[model samples]
Target: MNVAFTSRTLSLSRPQLFRGIRKVQSSFATCSVLSANRAVVYTSNGDPSQVLSALTFSNLPPPPPNTVNVRFLLSPINPADINVIEGVYPAKPNPNASLSSSGKGSQDEPVFVAGNEGLAEVTNVGDGVTHLQPNDWVIMTRQQAGTWSTGMNVKPQDILKVPRSLNDVEAATITVNPPTAYNMLHDFVQLNEGDWVIQNGANGAVGQVVIQIAAAKGLKTINLIRNRNDIASLTEYLSNLGATHVVTYDELSDKSFRQRVKEWTGGKNIRLGLNCVSGKPTTLMTRLLGQNAHLVSYGAMSKEPLSLPTSLFIFKNLTCHGFWQSRWYDSKSSGEREKLVETLVGLMRAGKLKEPSHEILTIQGSEGDEEASQKIRHAIATLAKGQHGKKILLKMEETF
Candidate 1:
């Protein structure tokens, strides 16, 4: 609560906002001890859909130069994490390699941590590390290898200096959704101001951020939500976030709906489309695009294969693309990344960017410890539920 925001930029890839007043507080903490140590361990190499076990803390490796030992405050179990545990995703981290680098051998093959985003604090900083000190909070640069653990030794490169302005809960929600949204918008296609973008699964984590970021950049969004349960209210909520239109899967088929889309844009060709639900939604979205537009598919929520019409492909010359945010951010320069992080944190703190709505799974006392891990797995299995909000989160928070 004592953290302060300085009148400076903290920073991402979407449309780089210029001329806007932005500032960040140096949110760093130093020198704290963790007592009630524990971690959510994956018992078998299977569905994080069921549950994750609570385990005792063991030995951790010494921090090398520019590396630090972190005590995790919170972590989110994203849909991506579930896919990794279920052996469906390809971006699995080398938890074994992370351990081996820590001078620990893996005849046991170090327990694989399943998340791609987290907020942690340094209890100790190794030699030659001046930018970070004890207690300074940082988000994993690239999931930080094994973040589900209560403690970890990670390189500075994989940890971004979190704006001391934000909470672990807010920072925990970040790292993935914001960047994915930013990248998908800025990369693949060049969207001009006032251009319209359409996306299925527009109510999920990445999709929600896409709405906010597009709004911030003066772009219009036609968001597609599943037709179920209070979707009208959900539509209104996203409208508050600057979505130009909120339509259901059923609307995509109506020729009248396409006419309304043109009306909203005033016939401004839709330049880009984002697809997470494949099959029918994917095909319908292509039909609605203008010539040479790009469709970027990040996930297949409907679990259906994407199909493109041959006419739209050759005649319209539309481009199809894929976005893997983890891979792209991993390849960017640190300076470029620092800019992105600073921008995102500044927006979040200023309340310009809405934080991903999360259900906090506390890791404290007896009750929290008993159910925290299970709650994490459950959130992932049903991330798309809970109305229109993204499943932002806090995993464990036991204090000294």
Candidate 2:
């Protein structure tokens, strides 16, 4: 809500005063976020607990030509984001001092801001911008743009306008997990109504999205998750989200489970398998696939190498591949991205898709450096524990 108003003074001549008035009007007319901006910055690559800090930049300038000023509303704490901050991610952020308004940080070496995905609102626009206006909602189109901040200034094309009909959580999360599920489901196999697909880590964010998307496409999912104390509740949750079948890792080991899957699919071929948890879970999922079935591995949460029996490839003719949503996005054009978003938006509006359970961590906009750093540090610590099944989101704007 930080904004500036233009005022006229009588001490100046008509020509001078008029010129001054226009200058002030041009900067303030769009309702810019004129206060100091805050961000979570890191100077060196290491654990987030050791290197991350909060910084405030003062006297921020307005967006330049063809650019728009964006105030962040929500940013999700993805595991990949933590990896980026640790310098292990494949895509690294570019160092730029202009990200901070205050003349702080070394000119020779710059710092990096954290977070990858989030939702933002446009607060001001440059002269040549036409696609977006003040108060418009948007999401980052590219990764590694440093989303954990109060606000930022960028070109209009860098963000995609979000439909007002979608809520903060839905809009904030659609860029990653949902798209990963959608792409993996469509790109690897030609599935039809009632076609069965089996996947490990079915309780994870991507797995949940996979269930919903598969259901919307009239495909069935054999969802597998880790055995938790609240196994029944977790099973019910995925079932409510349209999972055709739900089983825990323990149940997956049961000798009768193969027969159960057979009865569930009515002996029909399960053409696709999605493996996120590697090691034994991946091998187990691969065994369930039918002839010439596709097995796509996207993540190795167990940090275990996939053990594939040669017999599956030689006898069953199983097709194995891997998927990374970031790579897919990098290879595609903006038009392709738009098409994917449009399709997901339609499904969401039609109630065929829904956001998974998530938790909101409110980061105060006015906290001091030490206070803000402590809050973020505690949040990161909590994230590392993975205590909750809900996705952790940084709710930046107070009103939200």
Candidate lDDT scores, in order, read 0.73, 0.84
lDDT (10s digit) by residue, model 2, range 4-96: 334536667889878977776576435333356778888888989778887766534788999998888989988888888888878888775
Total clashes in model 1, counting residue pairs 3 or more apart in sequence or in different chains: 13
Encode model 1's per-residue lDDT on 159-190: one tens digit a residue: 88786679767787778889889889998888
Top-lDDT candidate index:
2
Which candidate achieves the best TM-score against the true structure?
Answer: 2
What TM-scores do the predictions have? 0.82, 0.89
Where does the lowest 10-residue lDDT sum fall in candidate 2?
1-10
Count the clashes in each prediction. Answer: 13, 0
TM-score of 2: 0.89
Task: Please state the error at residue 113 of candidate 1 in Å.
Answer: 2.4
